[model samples]
Target: MREEENIIVGISIGDLNGIGSEVVLKMFEDPRMLEFCTPVIFASIKTMSFVKNHFKLETQLHSINALDQIAPNKLNVLNCWKENVSIQFGKEDLKIGEYAIKSLSEATAALKDKTIDVLVTAPINKHNIQSDTFKFPGHTDYLNQELEGNSLMFMVTDTLRVGLLTDHVPVKDVASHITEELITSKIETVYQSLIQDFKISKPKIAVLGINPHTGDNGVIGSEDDTVMRPALQKIKESGKLVFGPYAADSFFGSNNYKSFDAVIASYHDQGLIPFKTLSFGQGVNYTAGLNRVRTSPDHGTAYEIAGKGVADLGSFEEAVFTAITIFKNRTEYNTLTKNSLAVSKRKRFNPKN
Candidate 1:
């Protein structure tokens, strides 16, 4: 494991035209973020300058030629592209798409090389970036492919954490995708992440039902009875604390969600609708089961309020803080594990010798 002091966080400036730059700038303005980790923005200096001037922000920006030059109390800007991107505020353009993709690619490369400890991505426009060069549904799918496809999308807040069984899929097609293998895999990913990354021992997970009232014992839908129930039972047999197929409608209302550490929703809306209702302006989208830690604000590009300076950055703030916390926790967990193993080896070998 690498030393915690060397942890550099790579941040992708989402769409240059959107609030991505604004949030990134706003986060840097708070001096507290620097104390936790060094943040390296994978964006061109020109784009950041335009944002700062347009918003009249009082934050300092430093353009660096190499990753080794990154330091504390400085906003490290990695100039991945040399093109001068025009600032259109809320307008979407092909140029913004190109720039966003460029920043993400460079930051992803840095993460893969272990130069960056974690990644915090700003929201990107799905429609604008639909060209051949950039053909990803969203950041999660894009990062999944880039990192060899081992990842899960999990929404998190201080009080609640929820993982999706199937993300960005149509509601009608959601049931088709919910097989025994898929549910089991997602459950295991969420389980392992809670235990290993988040440092939760014996995390309790609540799995939501696909149909109403947990399919009512096959009266409404058998997918919950046949597919979800069986898989969850198998998981429980493994001694993991998992419960549910609970009615999505009543789960949040009854406050049953509070009993578990995390909830596994059947689809996007099944999980996000209630989560957003509860944590609308302060939710954090976390990508679990990845080789490198990644997080993003729950909100979108907010194109209408791009340059207004009225974009409430509560969610972005939470996302940034969550990334730092997770990074620190993981670093500490790895250190403790290493120390325990070393001590055990010494004790065993000393007695044998």
Candidate 2:
């Protein structure tokens, strides 16, 4: 088996008008990062140059025309589009959003074709990227559609990990979507991810209640008791380390989320608000349950900080490392489980010796 040190890391340049380039360039600037894996950035040469010069980034932007031309131990930029892209830094433009989609589309193709081992996506604008071909809420939704597998919007840090039971849905619709079946399914996916992807053998998963104070004992709402609690009970009865229906309000503030390996919130904001606050908005967003490994920085496009040369590279760098780690761990796990029979049946032959 090939060592993970040579894993090709695929990157998608997000909104051309945002901090995607700034953080991405910052990640590649570190020479020591190249020792871990080869980076294949799915962005255009023109867009990169504009960001590099605008931010005065000393980082080298090496563009490789094709996959065959990969430069070992160097950050390689793949020209995602045949046409040129004119970047308008910190400005919301449809053209720039389209360019972001172009980068993502090409990177997705490369990932599917095994040109890259894992994908680390930069942030993209959810509004401007809407088009005929792309009709999903965000990266997680789009990836689920493309990969045809269940996906969990999992946010991870050094110690804390959070997963959203209902992702990219409207606030009004969040309650209606949180059914017993879904709560069970989403938490199941989270549990498996914590085990297989992160290599946590006996994962302890906690679920947060939907309403305030866990529906205040059916006063404000009842979804926590009627839906989530039942699902948790069923999952636990089936021999899973699942517990929850805890109030979302005091879950993080009281440090209750730290007790479990991963916490599953009923909705997006419920989980992400506390997660970003604790992790300082530098957590890695991992799309779990898919066959392929994909991760992104927790923060958004950050139009306010675009081209300022001040975008924090911590989250993006962590996302890259997390992707590599998950890919390696999953590969190793699969080898141990799926290929054990083949490996055990064949012993080293020494007839000639």
Candidate 3:
């Protein structure tokens, strides 16, 4: 795609004391990334400067004072703050968390206003970035509240896609949260996203059971038999190509996940443990079923490797590219459906008739 046709990607600077700035800089370092999309980082220029200098990296910076002045080839850093915030690197600071929130809030506003086509959020320390203002588990939860929609944390890679039925919830609390309604709704959302977001015409899905061996037909646990199996039957009756309350342990191990387009894991660790183990740096977390496009890296803010310049940009860059691809695919799908009835009629109408 040409530079002008490239989608506008708005990035939120996560905890500055973490690897957010480092990874963001590394993504744009290649210069070729600009040809695919126009990136505008919602961060203080000072933060970018500090990270750049500390790593001794070379890249041109274009401070975004005005939206219309965005340069296609330059790294656009919209100054969310005027003064330079202190870089603590490995330490968590209140000032850093507050600053991260500012960037997120502004970027979110821009997203809602259509200032950017898509958003690529950096990883934030959930505990530090929390307050009365930000009372959510993480980015996915925060955006779901902001956008007022049922959001599925869809983890993606080239070969596999996994969506969480319940994310960021503890193992003890997970059973209580897994209800018939929740499972049905999330599966429907995943189905729609498979068709609309991923452009799969007929997507097959696998639903992992809450318990081992899928309750072993009611011996291991009852939720799988009482809740998930019934819900899966109802979903299938509704004409969706969904199957399983399969045992989580054997689903991936038996290579059953490859037969379906997507897998719905019961909780966080159940899904992410295997996904990260297999895809790791190549994975992208996409928020499905929202009105706007949003994606993030599969990994979190690595405090250990914060300013060491060893932070890999694999997931972050993939997140940006994935956002752009989804945005473009959505636009194309919308355009295709605009006159679908007439198009169908014309294709079906024959000269003999």
Model 3 clashing residue pairs (backbone): none
Give candidate 3's TM-score: 0.94
Off by over 4 Å in 2: 341-353
Candidate 3 clash total? 0
Candidate 3: deviation at residue 269, Å? 0.4
Q: Over the stretch 76-186, how does candidate 1's per-residue lDDT look in tens digits?
A: 899887778787889989878888888899999998887888899998998887787777789999888878535888999988999999998988899999999999999
Candidates' TM-scores?
0.94, 0.94, 0.94
Cα lDDT listed for each candidate: 0.87, 0.86, 0.87
Model 1 poorest 10 in a row by lDDT = 1-10
lDDT of 2 at 205: 88
The alpha-carbon lDDT assigned to residue 26 of candidate 2 equals 79
Which tens-of-lDDT digit does each residue in 39-120 have in candidate 3? 9999867878878899888876788776676677678999877887888788878778888889899999988888788889
Per-candidate clashes come to 0, 0, 0
lDDT for model 2 comes to 0.86
* Cα error, candidate 1, residue 259 (Å): 0.7
TM-score of predicted structure 1: 0.94
